[model samples]
Target: MTVTATKFTPEVMLSAPRRSPGVPNPSGKLVLYTIRVLDIESGNSELLTEDPEAGCPVWVGEEKVLYLKTDSRGNTTFIVRSVKSPEPESYDIGKINAPLSDLKVKKLPSGNIALACSALVNPDGELVNPETDKKPLSSAKVYTSLFVRHWDTWNSDRKRSIFYGALGEEDGKLVLLGNTLTNALGGTNLSSPVPPFGDSADFDIGPSGLVFVAKDPELDPATYTKTDLYFIPLKTFTEPQAPAPRIIKTPGLEGYSQTPVFSHCGTKVAFTRMHSRQYESDKTRLILVPDINNPDVTEEFYATEDGAGGWDSRPEAIAWGLDDSHLYVSAEFHGRRMLFQLPSTPSKATQFPKLIETPKGSVVGFSVLHRPGSETTVTTADILFVSSTSLIDNSCYSIAHPGTLECRLISSTSKEGKSFGLSRSQVDSIWFSGAGDYDVHAWVVRPSTFSKDSKKKYPLAMLIHGGPQGAWNDSWSTRWNPAVFAEQGYVVVCPNPTGSTGYGQDFEDAITGNWGGRPYQDLVRCFEWIEQNMPEVDTDRAVALGASYGGFMINWIQGQPLGRKFKALVCHDGVFSTLNQWATEELFFPIHDFEGTLYENRAAYEKWDPARFANEWATPELIIHSELDYRLPVTEGLAAFNVLQAKKVPSKLLVFPDENHWVLKPENSLVWHREVLGWINKYSGVEEEQKSN
Candidate 1:
């Protein structure tokens, strides 16, 4: 069969069907994932449902599946469909008081299926329905707390919490028990599933109880990342009074607690915990509670002989082996998100995790597939179904054998890269000596039409990643995609410098209070390496782009000697001044990164302040910020643009009123790409070719 390759444009990337993590059925014969079902053995896939508003598909039992479908009017319906039946059974849950999402279900011991979903509720634990509930005549919001506003929105009297009810059958019709849903966190004045990015992963439901993570209400949310794990015992779906949730304390581990997974038997729980309260980028240690009934007895599985000498990579997501003897974890390694396996039980001797060899690209998520009757055994039949993506592929699923440590491709979004004119060969990397004489890794993505034998050279696009602690992983991304830039006739180079994760803790810690020091020098060396080594890259016609901390670097670069190297620059939601960063929502981020509060450590902030060196800013730049970006705030972008305009430097400012830290909406994303690419291309001379075409 002959297939035609197409240019991977912004529209193509945006219009592509998004693939979500899938859940496997109890039998493991079929996978209920990505709005489709795949027969594992036959390798045949069929759409299970279709709708832009449909999501959160979960398996109810071996033969049944449940999901939620919301209409344009904001009304949600609970859908239950049998694998054998042609039609699905749906019950109108009616219009929730707030936005309802993150559906989870667990079959109770009494044969009743308990359903839990998250939504906003008032301080009194009553559902907060902006559409149907009464509101004061004034639109003004008064807040006396630290978090008057969060990531993108202003704080209200309502908080995001979990609501629970039983899915039952009455008179041959599926219905919600008690004809109403009760807030699982009712009367607690606590919000489960933390804000902004938290989802179903923040809480898990088991036969015995529900486990969730919530920030300590007494602490200021803006300053502390301390969230405790809480367990709520469940007996009846409809209880007269919801039992007060008990905090599962992990002594000496007070940072962010996340991803609580219940053992298959519901007797134990496994989660990840960080040690520091202020640093959000601390190493996540795998934590295990052998007995849920005795929550105080917690064990740290991957601890070092001393306190800080052992494994350094932060575990992102974790899953347990079917037998619960082994735990599977995914963490950033070098530049890839690698999967590792470790014994679930604590060891007397120093122990390290074993690496599981998987396909190229990072493992986004995975599900343990246990064959029928093999749930209690560590057999070869048990497969870890992993979902991953790379710079070339949007989605790919592979079946990994735990025993052999071998991975085989099962299916992908498309047959091959030919479908989108992308190839794995075009994705390459290099290691160079950077600041501090340490080896720094950088990914180099060449255009699909790139050829070393050809006389043509491609313009250089230097892409910087955010997190400052985040690395440019070998993973797919819709926003700030290197492929998008490479396809535009630019050789995209993304450097994982100091402060980047996947390296060691000391490397990541080097960025603390040295935001513009080592990392900036690393980028300078990376640019020089490409210039001196790659004859196919036109470094003279180069452009640099970044967002968040990366954006901060662009602003920082505009004042350094490196500013003269870039032909053009793009800063998305970057910091304008280190001292003014106190206006950000998450104070802990700047506090920890800068080493202390602004008042307590004014010199640290002043040392790295980009505004201090604004006199050297002469680069033609494009500044992008969103009105809702509480993390960096719109003022940061405006402040940078103001300085540029005052100096009469060629510059443009683009602001999205509706977006937060990212341009998420499809239409908005298209505009973002067009403006950013057009600006950079014009300065890099690629615009002339585009105009002629």
Candidate 2:
């Protein structure tokens, strides 16, 4: 029996199964990944462990795996299970005293496993347990420096630090060597797996030692993006005392450092670096340390000239090839996040990395797979990657060979969208001449029911992406998804204008100091191009929506001549007044984008201040802000709402007290989608269209 498909709604998207990146075992024949163990050859998957709380599985060897299991009381335990046996062994490392996650394991020379995970720790380097720890006499926090608040959370005494200890068997039971884990950054006044968004990816464990990225303690976190690599040499997990970590400095690369991936040999490290100290969106240059023993020697792979002379796209997450002769890098190219292969060592002959084609989607995550004892041989290796499109949630594939670039499918979650009536054919793209004679790109997602022969006109949902530096890639996103708007009988258009990534460094830099200039002009051109080229779109019933920088642009557009073209607008956590942006925690972002500090660059802020032209905001707008969004702050939304109310403009305000810069919680997100869609539908005549039908 064939069941008719239903409209793709927020509920379907939110209920989709979330799959983690695949981690291949030592032999590459089996995968201990996500929540299930997959047999690569047989194409069979089974539950990794019976315990529901056990997750973040890391391969201990060919047949054994180690994972973390946290109870309802917030107490975490390390569990090691074997594929051959149903019973798993539990290890009691004593009271970690805090919630721990992101488990990583490395084999020690002493035939024991060295385990590491990130945990929130107090000043004295002890794990912080809010459940059992003593409560403060008063709810008060004093700040002497910057970073009083960041992202969504206010400053606290506890820091997210890496805790490590040795795992060995004793008296027929698994136990931590010291019965307690050692804080790697203890007494250093620094945090690893840096706050807000960092995870196990920020650090890597290898045979030689542990290398992690951390911001300089001397500098103010609120104003700088200078995160340096720190290395701690641990020859064996049985060290009596935790050694002091030393900084691995890259002379010219002074910006943010990320994804310090240690080579298979563990003697070297390859990571991405940005040159500009203040610019967060600068080009991420690939950097390599020849030897961890000698930290001073570093080389730049695929080296490009300072400003536009060489290869230009930013390299994201990286992994070492099987033979260590090459590196696999996933980066944004045009509209998709493509994977590329580059030499592990610096090559003067190579101008650009070789692109390795995969499925039609962004390469979200990838790892190199090698057969056991075949690390030195290049023939027995493959690249396992996770790909996803705007329509497909995620699909796992393995590139059989780098030479052939043959991608063999392993598994996929794409079938889950079938019942929701989604298809890849609904997604397309268009390029138009934008400001500064640059060709700007925009994605066009048509409704599932749309047909060229129908003569039906769909309302326009102009989605302006955030980051101003970020692009609307052909990737799956739970937030600001074009498909959701398309399902509501609208033609969703997402533009990658000036200051968007994956294009080039110069194009992205064009909007640094000219926030309301080139980008705005490009957006205007995008709208005009849509009207002129797309016959199926209803320009008269259009709505604009954005968040963060996009939200700021929406507010900016509210006071511009373009505001009259759209029937309504939606701004999520946008900036109201450029002068009051100092209230943001990341001062470096505004400093770099606006050209200077608020006090020193008042003219620049005043030039793009949306508050200055609030009188011109006549378009009916829906403003959404979260109380925890320290990046823009709720006050920004309230300020915009107050102005709209004062001017007697038709507007509505939706506030989420628990959400941050983005609506992350599933329930809250559902509400967000409903309210946003309802507001846009009411103005775009969708509500009227439904009633008339």
Candidate 3:
């Protein structure tokens, strides 16, 4: 078998089948999606019964999709869509966030009923857009997972008013503490009480009590950085007792680490190190340490991947099957991602994956949506993924390994013939060098309809990605507006330049202070490659558009000599200057520095400032960002806009109060897409340019 490296093209990746846990189901079968399922596998899927705005669907029995349906009037309601029955009935979970977290309606071994739930809360009355320099209010649409005591949800805080800058549930007694940002639990409910860290955390229940780790570093509620493990007793606090916290590790690892997992037997623990602190170039190391601190033989190796090859730390979503050998773990190795089940005991030199299931989108945290039965074997077991993407609805899939490729959406639907109507345009992976050995990864989505016989060329559009440490992957995007452009008459290019994650830590680290250096070269090289290889694309008519870190790229590009290569430039919530960004209070985490503060990196930051290049930016630009974009605040875009206006560069700005860093509403999303596409058409009307060429 030939293993081909991914082509840095966007066609296949953008349209690739993806699995996300947005459209949830009772079991991981019926998936509720916003778009109709297209080009799906034969007889494996059932088209959902409701509108595309519906979310979180579950199979009530075998024929129904349990989910929330949103109407055009901006009202969301819970309902059950049936496959065999062909009738849909409203099953209001009532004001609760649809697709309940760890949503389960199962009978216990002892036969008692259990129901759990969660949602984002904003008791602070915060109604401001997130400042790019400060920790944007955690209040903006963040979720907090919960476990409801009973079914009645009439008086819940989330139900009061689902209005603008709305507040989520603040009245429920959420049981599980699974990961950062929210409280999540696994297995049976814990007898131990929850901890108060101001931020979210996960837990493990043992014979002694409940054990969990607070990934935050500082004791200060605002600037927490260090992560530590602590044990909470079953007893509740009557008197004001200062809780005792025990440090699990002396150094406490580094960078951003969380999700301390307990071994199957409950005597040990496993967690991904993510990255090694700040600026440290190493892959996220997975280590297994024993529950007891024994002088001799306390810890042993379970399994681990080498190097900072862009692994997502805090992989708490791991599942260990009944038989120890059949261990399931999620990893982002081999450039793409797949679930690997390695044998517990190694007989041969290579203890390769025992049972494997690779999901379409990059698989993050995962768990057995349904564990194997008492008599189930390694070959005969059920595994569910929490992610699926065909561009519209993010849903889950039930992958029955060892059988026919049976991918059933927990909320999404699979039509009778083709699985889902959703089929991504073909994406091919390719790499190009920016400077020296430093290469960049990219995806190119070609125009839906193209002319091969005629020399007529199509317009090229550059789509930028955020997460200076995050990489743009082969996942279908509900908001990835570039696809619409491709469907029209435009060719789109997205590059995982130097600063992007997934390639390796150094690849990401290289961009820390050199954001405009190697990273910029990579984008330039991508443009040049498209010009040379994709002659069907018009070079001068090409435009650049991105948000956050990607938005920063556009700013830097406008300033560079390569700025002459692009015609129209669009900035979406991009960072304008490094100094202003650094000086502002970013969230509580002290990430601006690992060993020291930004005071230490003053010189490095100055060199990386994007504002310095504003004088050279002559490209006709469009600035579309929100007033409340905290990730890359409106100020950054404003700074660029100020420059463009002052220098008399053709520029415009589109600001929306309803949107934050990301625009989520359907109407808003459509508007955003239409605006971007319109800009491309308005400025880069390429028929004239191509004819001249």
Candidate 4:
């Protein structure tokens, strides 16, 4: 009998990575997140919190834990109590009426406490009344953002939704960052907005107020994206007085404003931006702003760099050693994601990022990785990352030792484990011929157990990625379903053709207006490669699969001269007409907008639309889409399906009721996999002996 690992199991019981380890209290012992109390330990850990469902936790003292609890009022009431000293007694000291993100707690050098939280929807950062259901108090109305999930992965300790951003300039002459946020009033008291680059999520400050800032990204109208840095001045804000911040500005920053960050020594600041292809990153530049808080005199914009730039290299994670000798920043260059080491001295070129981890095994290289530096250096670490492996689904690592940057497995929803699994892939790379003599690249995986002695050529499947610029990266794809197929005796291949990124910017640009031509050749070439190189792959029985842009490609391929090569095609939420796509509510990705707009690029749109070529289609196809998909809305799939059905082609359309661009939730994902499998089996003939074996 075919054996699937009994069933799926999650790996850890801890909270999500987006939620951070609670900041340690002054004595350096206690840490709390949610309802539970946490204690620092030296080795591998076990959950220590006593209360269940206690979401946000923080360390208050060596013997105490402070956590946020929603008292029917909807306000997150902060409670501090002794976890070690006996009776489990705790006191409710205060609460923030405003919704918050990246809540932080730290013991001050003076033995007092520093609490920092950001408010997004309401500027006044008013706390929510869970009991009364009152809205946040703010003059500026918050945008009912539909793109919230895309921009943030933060969870709130209270009713207000939370978002994370990096730090920016202006602190008490010292540098520091801890999850920075848009205060309820959308105003940061002292620091500027996060710069344009770097990624931020649920965050917490360092122990005893030593940690100070969080690096976030914001746009610079002049330069595009600049990393804006921010921090809470715990030492100064410890008084009864609320924080009073001085507004600071840099050279060329007269007009544009966005994400920002600060350097370790408090001497420099960095920023990032998402620029149209027109503005490529040059180098990391440092602009000096007057230290108005300092008695030192005159200062105008003196643009200078220690030569080690903070440019193109968008700063994601900023790690400052206890002594401030080593600095770490995460950056993506070429096809590999890496970490760069910035020396305490300005003269040295920022050292290239040392690779900590990749999809699986030894990451031959990386496309993106984020590591947060700390006084703990190689030992203590917190990292949030997106890998070709993780695909845009961000993953995290807590207590990431520089020794092993891999994060700890923790899911906020459950205390259960086994959420992630490591699977083995056999093909390093597969090559195949296209329309002409051109070639395509693909990676193939066989079922967990296979034998050359067996005569059965397995049923085959292909996975197509969206971005005409997006290429298939080697990573764990919860949706890719290759492993699940392999578990069911099907061989899987994912191809990266001419239009994909990671290969190079030029390769990506090549398909800008030529989507229907050369890129199509690459897809065909990949299939041929599978037929020729993968002897175990049944050439006659295969399926064409893709989503989003890939979905568009699949429909376009059906009308190609060699369209009948595959008997089955699976199109998942793809675009059928450039005209309809342009008219949709979806906000196009930056590069897509830059190439051309609907009005100006109409000719290219017509040439790229598969709907025009639908008459040439002859193969059977299956369509899957989300009713709420605005990106490559359901209309595209509907149009293609209608034409196919009208033409009398065997075609079917499946719509997910409550999903979007991507399907979420564990149970939904499981069903999705099953649906795709059933589609393949119903259309492509699976050998009976193969299923039994």
Candidate 5:
């Protein structure tokens, strides 16, 4: 039976990943945005910039601020403003003659700027702006041997490169010095900041003016793509210069290494390093490469041997402590992204890193205000600013300091009291005995009309999360939102089953080569627990739905011995044939998860291949697939639909030609929500009750 959550459960929890398109800015007319600074000591805030497009502010000394301003015509210029003077001057750090599409700009320590952009340059170091180029994309002939097609974009010679130089005298003029870092060999075909997709954090410009960069290692096709660290001296970036990179060798790390960050003193570098060369799920260990007159000495910085002890220990953002002895590392744990303060060097006395108290939600991005010579720093104080969000709210900004109980909220995304006609759902935590008697945690969202004493029993919608390595956390989701089901008068159950993150290392690794084993049992037991114990649920009219790995589980569930537990099932972008998915985009994921190639481990592939057991399928199902979904090719979804149709199990196929793995478009998402809910309503008769009420 489907049961709604009680009132007492607690609530909890993308990074430099280009802010998802779904993120909402305030809905209004074009209002000019101004940069404002708040003083913590005096609780006073003053305007810093009045430019409408001023954003991505970076602190330049004590009283100077550097920010980017983009105009209506897509022209961008960096502005350096002073705060100490009565009339702060805005220094026009003019535009670089490069495509501003997905551009990134960082203020270097030496009063210069480093830009990463997609540009076409001549041998003479002049930018050939595509908008004004004689040959446009329609007329240009593009050729590439590797990564011809990435996540979405087609790669040609117009890949991204790093260019460092100062602004010229003209308002928007750029001075070109050295050649593009990624194009030194005529064309390295390498993406820097690390493409298909990457951010400023992927590379670092140290205080010493040397650029510590990370990119796919130039290797033959036989080897898996491995990212390594390289040193690019700023001095070499002169006229007629070639981009020279000195590779930093890590003896123990054979896997990919990115996110290279240098310490405040520039004597050490910290980056996430994985060990296994070919495994995608390999544990990333945070290591400190000390500058002891050698580029090869890399030592573990965190106390834990395997690092943070979850699905992936690789923290996305790492910041140094003002003292330079500790680092604030952010990683996903138990469905929530948490921040921990760990020492720079290993310590026998400290066994575990300390978790800094944060709002019980995801910490997306943060900036630290070191204030080196300030009064508080004179006595040693920790000061930080964070941007975070929860299920009920959009992102908000806050300030965390030494004296605060929690980070103090400085600004909120929502208006002070304006209601947006959005209703908050009641979500509660539930724990039940899963496979092997392990305690499995899941969340239940109650319909707005549900009451503990009410006689009305609601049908349940079991929502399985995608990442076999991911978890359903206490966070808001645009896709697979539990609130949507709740709004449709169905109680939603989201379980952090086996192999889900935030549990521990062992639990996450359990489903590695045994995909259809314990994780499926965890879902079965989670379903059974709700049916037997919860009196407010209509268990007999439940529908199971999943996407990605969760979608794989939905297919597996239809063939299980207790497959009759659910009335219907919906699988979106699921894997039907494990063997057939070998050609999927990420070769390393399935290779490592299934343990070797499909031929090498035929038994492993057959054990989890849902298509093999189609004869056992009896439940009515709906299959959804997108053409652009490279991770799980659209063929898997089509094959699953073919089986359901052949067996006459009553199925329908929903396909999106333009969308990728996710139904990200606004209209498509609306259709997805309606169709999936409509299928459940048709089978379970839940919509009739809503209409009658």
Candidate 6:
């Protein structure tokens, strides 16, 4: 079959289907969704709703689906539809008066439904209008605050408040009850979905109608970025007073505690918490509260003890089995992000957690299906699904319950019969022995036009992954795609060396304070392994490129003895000096905890500082940075480029003033690819005709 490369341009988002535990569907069919719903049993799909701008559908009960839809006027309205019914009932929650942020539906034990929403309102308990509401400290033009500017927006006084509203149907029309539970208490900057770093995993509700909020209550972002859990008795009525919210303090006093999940029996609440309050890189451990009402009685629950991706080992998503005896966790390990099952009450002291087998890719999200009266929770396995992607294929599938080995393809619903016009490239994994006798893994994507029988030597491009802690798993990426390099007739090799997650914790921890040691050696070994085993690779014409931590390694690589191996280098948002990078946002924890503060461990910082080894740098380099990237700060890129210029080395600097860390915008990304590709072609001496498709 002739293969062609196609640029993907669809904006698709899928959400995990929500269903009440122990509730029998009776149909025994599974619904996979991606803007449309596919019934797996019959291999048929029916359009639920399509407005071009609609949120994920939430299961209100066994029969009803609730979701938010926005109209052409930019006004959003809530719609509820019965699964078997054709017409949908719409509710206007006065969005113009109090615009909702994160809307969620919860069922109380009393069988009543309530909506938990976040709205940006003023101190006067009214929705803050950007056009009308006066700014805080009206006279001062230059105001000072820690979170004054986060990501892309300036912080304002219009704080988000969690509101509770009882849902019911009156005369066939949906009626909402109760005012904002938090509005009356002097509007707080309480975010339902915490800003900057929080996800849908930040909060959850129990059958008792107790809504738990994981929020950072107006802390100075510069010094502290801590989020604690707070609970409020959900008001299911319009008239009666709502109870004040109470705090559920964890032992990690200064750290964050979030993604609260209530047990099926509501007897236990499990959440993810960080150990240190200020450091985002601190180990994230699972914490269980026997009684959330008495949160201090908490114990450490070890499910991701194998270590989640470098930063932490906390589960991103959680759900309990119908019998409530097993908890399913979606965690990152090795290079793949997969699901794991932890016995609610483990009988053995040394029985490690059981991994739910799936494809070698990221398990983006999952949902659990259980009958109302099942004999055991063993049948309550998560319908673990992964939007699996590799260097060539972009498909999604759900592993069958009971026997996770059965991989069922559900990509039909998502593709909707549209062909990508892309051919699958020849992909394989290669392992090599590296520093400390450790096995390093690298993913190799062969050029689309090449074959093993051709015996042609293809130019190689070694792509380094960032996170120094993050692994290059079998996943699809819009940025740093190996396929793009392969499309240009270059062999791509992405390795997960020491310090990369997914390997055991001991291996990941090896590069904590010693970033330039084993990881560099592993990269060198990976390169040598490829040149030796893969006769189709042209090692003399190879180039190395990376972003963020990967970018840092590129700088480190140029100073190492292996520097001469690469013809050229590309670094984006890379770290140049540890001492100079101390002021970058969100890196405080890892720099302080792992390497100790600059004052305490000056030698460690200087030992691996790329800026210090400028005299040894001779490779032609391309440095890219973004002004909005406070994480690494654009200064790091500027310093690296200045050093190259001063050393009389061939170099070019690309700055994206409007972008952050990663070049996200379509136009900016095009420029990034063109510039980097152009650089590789020039330095590697590849002809113009061979560089483009």
Count clashing residue pairs per candidate.
1, 1, 85, 95, 6, 4
In model 5, pairs of residues that clash are 1-531, 1-539, 2-537, 13-474, 13-475, 334-502
Query: What digit string (tens of lDDT, one per residue) describes model 3 on residues 1-693?
Result: 012213212333234344434333434434344322222223244456536666544334434444555454334454444455345443444332322222322222222212222322233311112121245355444324222111111112221001111112123311211211112222112211122212122444333233455444233322433444454332221112212444455233454334555544545555444434433233444545455232122221233345323233223245545443444566543234446664333332154444354445555444444332533556235454445432322334444352235554433432210232223443445677776586677776665345466686778888888766666665545666445556556777778887675665556667655677787788878888887788878887878888877887888888888788888888887878866663233333224322235576566656767788777889888888776554455677777788899999988888887677777666677667667766766788853443555
Please tell me which predicted candidate would have the highest TM-score against the true structure. Answer: 1
- TM-score of every prediction relative to native: 0.96, 0.95, 0.68, 0.68, 0.81, 0.85
lDDT of candidates 1 onward, in order: 0.85, 0.83, 0.50, 0.49, 0.65, 0.66
Superior candidate under TM-score, 4 versus 5: 5
Give the per-residue lDDT digits (tens) of candidate 4, residues 472-538.
6543445664555655567778777766654544555567667787788777677766677778888
Deviation in Å, model 2, residue 57 alpha carbon? 2.0
lDDT of 5 by residue, 356-393 (tens): 66665677766556453543352125666666655444
Full-model lDDT, candidate 3: 0.50
lDDT by residue (tens digit), candidate 1, 446-535: 999899999998999999999988999998899988999999999999999999999999899999999999999999999999989999
Sorted on lDDT, best first, the list reads 1, 2, 6, 5, 3, 4
Off by over 4 Å in 1: 1-5, 85-98, 168-175, 348-350, 379-381, 691-693
Which residue pairs collide in model 2, if any? Answer: 547-551
Q: In candidate 3, which residue ranges exceed 4 Å CA deviation? A: 1-217, 220-224, 229-255, 260-269, 275-283, 287-316, 333-336, 343-361, 364-376, 379-387, 390-425, 451-454, 587-598, 686-693
Give Cα distance to truth, residue 63, candidate 3, Å: 11
lDDT of 6 at 494: 89
Evaluate model 1: give its TM-score: 0.96
Q: What is the TM-score of candidate 3?
A: 0.68
For residues 601-680, could you state the per-residue lDDT of candidate 6 as single tens digits?
A: 88888888888888899999999999998778788989999999999999999999999877788778878888998899
Model 6 CA deviation exceeding 4 Å by range: 1-34, 42-53, 61-63, 69-76, 81-99, 121-149, 152-161, 179-192, 210-226, 235-244, 249-254, 302-314, 346-350, 370-391, 412-425, 685-693
**Candidate 6 TM-score over all chains jointly:** 0.85
